[model samples]
Target: MVGWLLAGSMLAGACTASSPEVERAAPSGASEATPATEASSQPAAQGSVGRILEHLEALDRIAQRNGGTRAVGSEGYDESVAYVSRHMRQLGYSVVSDRFDFDYFEQLSPTRVERLKPRKAYVDGRDVRAMVYSGAGRVSAPVEPVGFDLRSNDHTGAGCSSDDFSDLPTGSIALLRPGPCYYRDQVVNAQEAGAAAVILAFPEFTRATGVLRPTLLSGAGIEIPALAATDGTGVELARSRTRLRITARTRYSPLRGVSLIAERREARAGDVLMVGGHLDSVMDGPGINDNGSGIATILEMARAVAAKEPDAPVRFAFWGGEEIGLLGSTAYVESLSSQQTTSIEAYLNFDMVASPNFVRYVYEDEIAPAGSDEITDLFTRYFNRQDIEFKTIDLGGRSDHGAFIEQGIPVGGLFTGAEMLKSRRQRKDYGGRAGASMDGCYHRPCDDIDNINQKVLREMVGAIRHALFALLTR
Candidate 1:
């Protein structure tokens, strides 16, 4: 149970020979192709990723003046789980915020998008954003503009090529326009995209996050449901050519986040460098860099690599409702136990590695495991031996190291994107604007701390403290 369960440490790199069974529910632009490094080894070699992005910008100024972080079941997520279990028990180690009790939600008010009949209208949630598991009450129906309302890729029935919806009917309300899937693949592709209920517009005028606003319709077998809207209410229901009647009334409540599994026993523990982030955020936005810069770079690199002295025994995690879907690193790697998943060997992740237009990429997944290709060849050999500028993307599925890469774990790290889309090769290597979105305040509420970029959050905390001081010191 607590043994090193290795299905490749729950699938990390080499992505376990292409694994993509089923997990597409949280995907809405997460920008970053990679480029930008060297935020340390200067000004006094500042150590541990510049002392962990100044504690991930002071937990992004305490979720930008309180509200954007520690969000799982509020009390600002149990006071950010007693501020990372009192900073990993003051660095001595042995901390655990692990107290599982999910079914928490908060957005107490505002989420009404009516537009009944041949006239009348409204919409909010800071304009248009709702998709956490989205499915509650109040819906008048009659609308079905199905352009890209996606359930998972229904480009609109017998036309968008086809995944078939048996010819959409029964109370028709399905409509979509977000892609690359997940959000229950637009609610199982709008109930198989045949539609009878669904509405998720946002082809252009973007920026949103809201959905999963339920009150228990079904659980265990999990079916969250869908009922969203925006794209300026689909540009006022496409200037109303009539037929509109969509009502909306999403209120939410499903809180309970507690993930903390601390271990620091080095005496040559070797090949077991797993890190963590996601101290629950996304409610009035307390997610500093979409993860308070991955729990301030794994709690200040688990207090500077357990005080710069460890050859392995570094497992400082602190996840809980990783904004909903990575459900605490996939329920702690699906509660591991397959021959203890092969006495693990590699898994160095640091979700949302400090933000501010992060680049200096990695994760090509080159059959990943020679200890994570010697850790992305040591950040592609320290950003091409310090010439700086990054980009290497390709290992899809976003974060919690994609649940130890779905159960194989030979993964890698460094991310500064969310709600992504900035290309043209990331504006010719981290230049900004070639399609803008390296986190345009990712989970909105203006992803606070004045939407960071402090030199791309100091080269994403010096390429994650020089890739954890070269993978936990050799």
Candidate 2:
């Protein structure tokens, strides 16, 4: 899954609870149809829980052998691609290892922030740290606080607008707070206003002890350094009105990564049905539940359905660089000709499908393309038949689906949950701890195989298989 905050405006701020009454209704103006019976909806025997866990275990071992990460531009990611490709070939599917280039970022040294006038240096990784994609630079200048409302209860919306930096002097470090907008917008605004650097302050109400770590998403045309600060450090800098020195050393290199595309050797012609999930993990951890669950589920589905012939061609994609941005899927979509693009009838994405405190979630149809409601209904019908309750989530350009949606392709998918806290009502429906994050190990080093909820995984896999057959036959 993409980093919730790092992906910037591309992501919906957070997953919000859907109104149960509204979600359960059939799509507007569509006639209701009879639900499929068990005989018709049965999945392949190979699509078992044991088989999916075996795939996860293989991926876990791959990460363990390759420095505990499967992030893009890493050896672990390459191995992951090889593993999937080999499996697809064994299953008699034509597999393609599509390669693309991306800008890879690396921080070379410890970032430095100092109060020059007072001769005090703040601790690195505690009081200050460089934001991801920050340009390499060192500057000593006066610190100017821009657009701050220290007295107001709202701590957001400080440096979001260009007007906030209208009076900022050239070569000065602009001090600001996060949100009410993207971190990218604030940094870009400061850079355009001639500030030598930027310091983004953490919100006062946050209980986090360390400095904020945000991403500028991309470093194009950004020549100045950007840093994140603790709330205390920001307030002190604003009040003292002193000179400061900021230093950050970083590099962006051109690197290649691969996305694996697989399809049956004798796929049918006409409109194609696509199913996919991101394959790369964050540099932080193994990312077992963040995406390993999705990958394993889809791989098992591919194995189960390999022998069956569908009405339309089914393409399975394992996307790369989704953690940085939707690089692989975006490239794939952009590379397609108009005719090729139109041939793709719909896309189904599965990401983070087994949160420890899981909730059954279907992608909200309202925000997706025209034909997406049908896809949403397919998953909902399966869950409803199983007597399972589900919620709807609006994921705006957050995952691989965003690329397909850009070209007016209809898309729908399932998600257990990620990063957001489960409410008391959710606890009642799903039977998990209220106020705890749905996936407690999300994006952390603890996101290993043990982080997954096996019960949730099994249920989600059943729903996925049901929807897969329904779409193929229709």
Best by lDDT: 2
lDDT of 1 at 234: 57
lDDT of 2 at 408: 92
lDDT of 1: 0.55
Error of 2 at 274 (Å): 0.4
Alpha-carbon deviation at 290 in model 2, angstroms: 1.7
lDDT of 2 at 174: 91
TM-score, every prediction: 0.33, 0.87
User: In order, how many clashes per candidate?
Assistant: 72, 0
Candidate 2 error regions (>4 Å): 6-47, 110-129, 139-143, 153-155, 158-160, 179-182, 202-214, 228-246, 310-312
Compute the lDDT of residue 215 as modeled in candidate 1: 19
TM-score of 1: 0.33
Candidate 2 per-residue lDDT, tens place, 196-258, comes to: 998887752123445434667677877898888878888888998799988889888778878
